[model samples]
Target: MSQGKQLPEFENEDDLAAWIESHDTSEYMDQMIEATDEIEVLRTRFSTKPLDVRLRTEYLEAIEELAERRGLPYQALVQRWLLERLTQEAPDLMTK
Candidate 1:
């Protein structure tokens, strides 16, 4: 067994993710403080980064049309569709 170190304050999920990628969960899981009382969170937000990709203009226009019908921004529609596809084809990608 390895000695566990104190977990640091994470600024965001991305920061915590970077730490997890380099550290073994077993090494730190045991060091966590036990919950003595109920904890409540007021809000939840996901951190996102800008991703630029080139696509065929026709496909982009079609996406825009579909998004418009759904009253959503094209980018949001694309993200939703991509997430749905990833869930089916590559769930591991979602976790990472």
Candidate 2:
């Protein structure tokens, strides 16, 4: 590998991502390290399971229209509404 310039230290993943997005990674090829170490991957807190709920066509259409106006998927809007209601009703249950 060529003696390329050293990589800059980033405070967080966002900074590293921004740097990589703006710069040519080819220059940092020599500074990169192989991922041989075994790392534990933790499950995400927002992991979701498939839910099957039957809703009336009119309600579904209204939800789809609202979600479209808000630039979000209908299911995501529904999830957000549900979470919001849950938080309002029982804030303790919503705690991580």
Candidate 3:
């Protein structure tokens, strides 16, 4: 639902193959594989169910304030935080 975060839609291998072929260049295969690997990492990291955390009123307010200041929804802020943490902890698990 975010402004620029549309989920990907790949109907089938033919569609994907067409896309790959259309974008093909000498380095495109390597880049495409790297991007696919990165997407797999993202799926593995973020597919886990969220854990419930109890927060004090003031702490919750602070988080909300920070999210508002960054112009991001609370969930997006949390996702970015987790992604950053994961990338820092496992540098090889991320891609450019």
Question: In candidate 1, residue 82 scores what lDDT?
Answer: 89
| Model 2 CA lDDT for position 9 | 95
Tens-digit lDDT track for model 1 on 1-96? 346576678999899899889977775776666669978878868788999999999999999999999999999999998899989998987775
Candidate 3: tens digits of C-alpha lDDT, residues 1-96? 234433345799898777666753444333334434433344345345777888898987888899999999977787798789989999898875
Give the clashing residue pairs of candidate 1, or none: none
In angstroms, the error of model 3 at 9 is 35
Q: Best to worst by TM-score, what's the order?
A: 2, 1, 3
Top candidate by TM-score: 2
Candidate 2 global lDDT: 0.92
The alpha-carbon RMSD values of the candidates against the true structure, listed in the order shown, are 13.1, 7.6, 13.7
The C-alpha TM-scores of every prediction are 0.51, 0.52, 0.41
Give candidate 3 regions above 4 Å deviation: 1-48, 92-96
Residue 78 lDDT in model 1?
A: 93
User: Residue 23's C-alpha lDDT in candidate 3?
Assistant: 55
Model 2, 9-78: lDDT tens digits are: 9999999999999999988888888879998999777666999999999999999999999999999999
